[model samples]
Target chain A: MTNLQETKPLMHLLSATFDSLQSATPEQLEHNPFLQLRKQGLDALARTGLPTPRDEEWKYLNLAPYIRHPYQLPAGKESLSHLPQILPITTIPVVFFNGLFQPHLLSPVHGVTVTSLAQLLDRGSHDGTALGEQEHSIGQLLSPEDDPFVALNAALLHQGALLHITQNPSQPIYLASITQSDQPLFVNLRFAIRLSTGTAATIILDLRTLSKTAPTFHNIVSEIWLETESALTLIFLQNDTAQNYGVLTTRIAQTARSRSRLYTITAGNGMVRNTTSVQLNEPEAETVLYGLSVLRDTEVADHHTAVEHLAPNCQSSELYKSIVADQATNIFNGKIFVHPEAQQTNAYQSNHNILLSDDAQVYTKPQLEIFADDVRCTHGATVGQLPQEAVFYLRTRGLPETVADVLLLHAFAAEVYEQLPLEPLRAWIDQQLSHRLFDIVDLAADRKLVDLQFATS
Target chain B: MHNAKQPLLTIENLHVAVDDKQILKGVDLTIYPGEIHAIMGPNGSGKSTLAAVLAGREDYTILQGRVFFDGKDLLEMSPEERAAAGLFLAFQYPVEIPGVSMLTFLRTALNEIRKSNGEEPIDTRTFLQRVREAAQLLELGNDFLQRAVNVGFSGGEKKRNEILQMAVLRPKLAILDETDSGLDIDALKIVANAVNSLFGTIQSYLIITHYQRLLNYIEPDYVHVMYDGKIVRSGDKTLALELEAKGYDWLRSETLSSIELPSTTT
Candidate 1:
């Protein structure tokens, strides 16, 4: 890997970012756990460097455009002037701006303990207990040796959230992260969640941008641990702008009879990459991963998922759908691994894509590796265009060309959206998807046609 | 009779080609209000091509000639425009629109046609009432309206759905393109009964078929035999029976010998 990085020559693009680590406050560096973790992360990144197209996992995605420039750490200010409108729901929300946790935006909660990681580090610093041991245990859940982006995010981690659910929560909890800055900025965020035994809850993580043209780069890492017989639903909503770049890595581990479902909906961004990993460590554990991406213009979106069944009688299923239009591009890579001891494992994976224009492109790879002899595993992929016969059929019914196209596209996407567990959230996401897909001009013209027909009839 | 009145549709020396290959050559026909005209032909006799060209399908190109519907240039209108102008074609194979329900599809079509005629759109209650009546006429259950358009329908069900659409939209000129090709005897009777119930003095039909069996149920006032993209013979309903009894070879040989070409039919 070192020799490969030396040959690429673009690996130095991220080395310049390490020098900016001195910008951290002296007090933060004084903490032994924070200082050691940052040093270890930096060393790991220096060895592996950035990924190139030659890498098997990144064959379809290139990171040269994102890593060419050196970004400075943003010193975010406490400005409530540009906050997004709060969702109209009975839940608690924790807001962060440019990787800085805002205390004023934290809402009250009754059944869970929520705090910032910065605050935890501060408390550990004054208590004189060995915090490094605890940090090392949590860091074991992620493998930075295999991914350079994970190392980069860990090296620059500053502010994030820590949630501990001890009992079944009465309401959902939301973590809203807002990225905005006047100049080019790089932000790293970390989240650690622990759901205790027999507890059930839902958590929504929303990544949003205030300005559409702000040049911001965000690196986020989340690790979730589900105890025995617990159930949790984790939803990630990525709604950035055309000028921003983002990388998200999620790691989840399940115990005996535990259940977890991860849902991701990606819409707006110039470039976005998502990596999700889940491990069923005990028997009878199950996990489900579902995602939908709608891209237009010259935007690019990529999703890479890995699910490992390490114990017997475990199950995992994954389904992802994408629609690309104009000159946009998309990629989906899903891998399922069944260990030697994972007998009777039932794993299924599928990826479906729709290209709406001549220039649109999609690359899908669904892979499976089963070591057990008695396992039922299947994986497949499909890429296609909207049926011309269906479009002409609708046109013969008096629907205009654009209306017919939009209707068919919506139907293709509804297969994934209709499966959302929450009713209100599904409705909200459906509205957002409609607004993103149809322009105001097309919608207004359709309305006028409808009115004309009504008036004449 | 009504044949003395102004014709509802007039085709003059129409020549059409699909994929740059001529499929229709010098076709001439006319239909008046309140007349049922049936065109019978053998396979590859340009029967479906005529229906497709009338419906404004983009696959075909008009090499020459013209078509006028209700004294307006038909070739100049788009498919949707033609539909709104009270021209309906019951497709030989109905398309499957997976997400759109039958009720929504029918309602949209009916409303658009009504709008084009300078009338107000039908309210929900009235539309539902009309749909119930049409469904009952076609012997379809009420639950069928909620299913996706032709997604899992059998051949007979799909044919019935097309007639149900026609009943709701109420087009002035109805063109049935091989509607009885894949139907069983019972389904054929049901479809024939539906079309007969919807006929009126102001409406006309251009039923294109290959068998003389369909005319036995919905009798036609005129029967034309198409051979090599042209109508070679014309007569009353007895012509269909004569052709059915003697087979299309008799007409093919008659037309081919007149044109000085060897008969290709066996």
Candidate 2:
């Protein structure tokens, strides 16, 4: 165990804000169901302090660069009219600015309930109905004591969305979380999503910054609950700027015969870390985890995932690919845990990466811990450069060397991009990847030669 | 069709080495315009090395020699530049590119050649029409255009693909490097037919092969036997059939005795 005393100054810098939040007025803190949870989270943080590189989980990533400056909370919301909309607006959009939900940008839909935590808290007491259900679902699966960032998010939690789907809707829902600030600030956000039994829905969560040069720190925590025989698909797009830092922790709990899929796309930010944990608590549950990370220009991206099988006859599949270039670094840690009682568990994990530059670095660990005798588990990881023969073959076809390289890289990333369920989103992601990876502006014009159509169920 | 006027390709005592081990030791050959020349040799006789050096593969080092294509220095150009300058090598073992479609690859190559010749790129409609016509002439289906370049293709299919590319690119000097090695008899005839369909007075061919069967279909105008990294015999097409009848060991012993007789006489 590493001692936290060596980073006393850094710990003090974070604790000062916690102390001020503790001194809020009684009216501001009274009747808040999260108040006790916040206290517990702060106490847990004080016990563990900040994690150092000596810790096994933080061995490859150093947090010293992020914690060097003292970051204060944003006081109020800024203007939102000038921000550019990156995705299609056909679906219902729930906007969050600086961790606070903005009601004006929301589109109301039937059989769906969208509200903020602050609104629910302001309405005071209610019958044991939707409000009670929101309280029961939020913060139920994630334990703040296990992670310091989750604890910090719980302690300084501002506002987030509470989404509930009672019936299957005709269209998907889009959650847009935007952070904008004139000065350096720290923002904490929390979200809870509950799907009723036999319901199906697709949710797209877009996390981005309004400006490319804003120095912001975003700590986000989300808890998702799926009832029996329910199905859900969650797509998370983490696209920030070079001047921002973010950490996102998501916990998903699935019931018997439920199905879920989580797709995470990380392409921006100076330093970003994502931790996604899934619990198969009932029999015959299925989950698929897919992620793609494109890092360039000295940026760093890390993804840590764990899927635990606690019951019998459950299956899980995980696939993640990373493209690192220009001195950038990418880290991936994926684990599949099968308990003694969880027999007949079929789990597979694969992590493949392409390092484009000589200075690019990648660290990948795919682990399977199976205590059950009858279970089948497999995991593999590969890191390599572009195939030399393939490059020479394209050059023989008269494509310039640079053009050949760009085409090969795009093909490498298309393996993961093809897994997107929606056609429009897939095309959008394909265009964005081409621009960011190779500076190709009109990739759509070349679509006739490279595009492949797959049926979506 | 042979015009005994000026040589189209001239290799002047070409000496080549791969990994510092000499492969082609002082070899010379000449081909006239509109003439199909065949070079027959045993394994490891540097037949492939000659093709690779002409294609500018960069793995082989030229110790001392010069190759002139038409009137320009051929060794000074890059592989693509050589292609643009009307030189092509049909690989014995064609490479497999997993995600690049055949249509995309051929279009890019044709446009690149046109650009180098100071011409505009071919429009999509005309390009597709030409590609379909060429593919049909080689007995390939439309799906072959959408498939990745030679990926999952059978040996015969890959050979036909090489010929299809030859028809599309229309190079002046096409060097077929043992392209009939893994092909069956039917595929051999189809490939030969494709080659003969494109043959004209403006083009020439250098066919490198180990068997006389390929020559039965294409019928080279001249045949040369290569031994010990150098040409030891030169004649017309009958030389291939005679060598096929007696095998290469007889020719090897004859060359050895001729050299020894010269040394003893001196």
- TM of chain B vs. native, candidate 1: 0.95
**TM-score to true structure, per model:** 0.89, 0.89
Cα lDDT listed for each candidate: 0.77, 0.78
Candidate 2 TM-score, true structure as reference: 0.89
lDDT of 1 at A344: 93
lDDT of 2 by residue, A302-389 (tens): 8999999999999999999998988888999998999999999999899999998889999998877889999989888999988877
lDDT of 1: 0.77
What lDDT tens digits, residue by residue, belong to model 1 across residues A312-364? 99889888999898888899999899999999999989899989788989999
Task: Enumerate residue pairs that collide in model 2.
Answer: none
lDDT of 1 by residue, B83-169 (tens): 787788888999998866787677776766676667878898998998998999999999999888899999999999988888888
| CA error at residue A209 for candidate 2, angstroms | 2.0
Displacement of residue A158 (Cα, Å) in model 2 is 2.2
Tens-place lDDT digits, model 2, residues B123-218 = 878988989988988899999998888999998899899888888888888999998989888888888888888898229999999999999999
Q: What is the DockQ of the complex in model 1?
A: 0.36
Error of 2 at B126 (Å): 2.4
Q: Is the docking of candidate 1 incorrect, acceptable, medium or high quality?
A: acceptable
